[model samples]
Target: MKSKLKMKDEILEYTHKEIENIKESFCKEYEHKIQAVIEEKDKEIHAMQKKFKDLNEENTENKNEIAKLGKMLEDANKKIKKRDMEMYILLDENKKQKEKAAKKMNKVNELLNNLQKEYTDNIP
Candidate 1:
């Protein structure tokens, strides 16, 4: 009866040790799974951050290009205005020259008529 009791005691001890080993293994596996999930999340976060950064860079580039185009348009507008002013000046100069030419032509016609009349009177 004492031997049977000792054998029962040994069996109980073995069972307790087996239970503890199972618990330890379960804890380790749970820790490993949690660590893997954390690593995956870290990778995802980094990827998201990089994507945001790239988008920001693209946005900045687009803004700069827009600004450049706006500046170019402004410059072109200035040139067009300058050209318009120059054209107006040239047109005014041309009008003045035409008036001068018409005056000169009228004077020459009067001189020709006077010369013809003088010659006709001298012959008579």
Candidate 2:
């Protein structure tokens, strides 16, 4: 009876050890799967960060180009204003020249009339 009880105890201990080993193996597999998921997420995050940086660079370049275009537009507007001022000055000068020419023509007509009157008086 004593030998039989010892064998039963050994069998129970062996079964318990096997169960514990199987649980440990399952835990290790779970940990490896979790680590793999974490690595994949890190790679995805890195790619997104690089894309965002590229977009920011592109945005900066666009802003610079817009600023250059605005400066060019301002210069063009100044040139147009200057040209308008010159045109106005030329028109004023033309008006003064016309007035002078009209006055000279009137004086020549008056001189011709006076000469004709003197000749008529002498003939009579």
Candidate 3:
């Protein structure tokens, strides 16, 4: 009976050692998996940041182009207004010259009528 007890004791000791070794190995594997997941998340975050920066640059360029077009439209409108003013001045000048010409024509007609009356009286 003493021999059987000694064999059973040795078996129990061996089982305990095996259980401790399995626990250590499982902990190491769990830590390695957690580190791998962290690395993958870091890479995804970096990619997202780069994409956001590129979109900001594109938005700025579009705003600058719109401003340039607005300035060009303003300049074109100014030119149109200046041309309209010049046309009005030219039309006013033409109207004044027509009035002067009409006055000169009336004077010439009166002189011819007076000459005809004098010649007819001298002949009688």
Instruction: Give per-candidate clash totals.
Output: 0, 0, 0
Once superposed on the true structure, which residue ranges of model 1 sit more than 4 Å away at CA? 1-13, 117-124
With a 3 Å backbone cut-off (N, CA, C), the pairs that clash in candidate 1 are none
Candidates sorted by TM-score, best first: 1, 2, 3
Model 2 — TM-score against the truth? 0.70
- Residue lDDT tens for model 2, 5-123: 88898888988889999999999999899999999999999999999999999999999999999999999999999999999999999989989988887888788888888888789
Tens digits of per-residue lDDT for model 3, 7-121: 8988888888888989988988998998899889888888988888998898899889889999988998898888888988988988888888777777777777778778787
> Which model is ahead, 1 or 3, in terms of TM-score?
1
- How does each model score on TM-score? 0.73, 0.70, 0.56
Alpha-carbon deviation at 79 in model 1, angstroms:
1.9
| Whole-model lDDT values for every prediction | 0.98, 0.91, 0.86
Q: For all the candidates, what are their Cα RMSDs to the real structure?
A: 2.8, 3.4, 4.7
Tens digits of lDDT, candidate 1, 7-117: 999999999999999999999999999999999999999999999999999999999999999999999999999999999999999999999999999999989999998
For candidate 1, the 10 contiguous residues with the lowest summed lDDT are 115-124
lDDT of 1 at 68: 100
Q: Select the stronger candidate by lDDT from 1 and 2.
A: 1
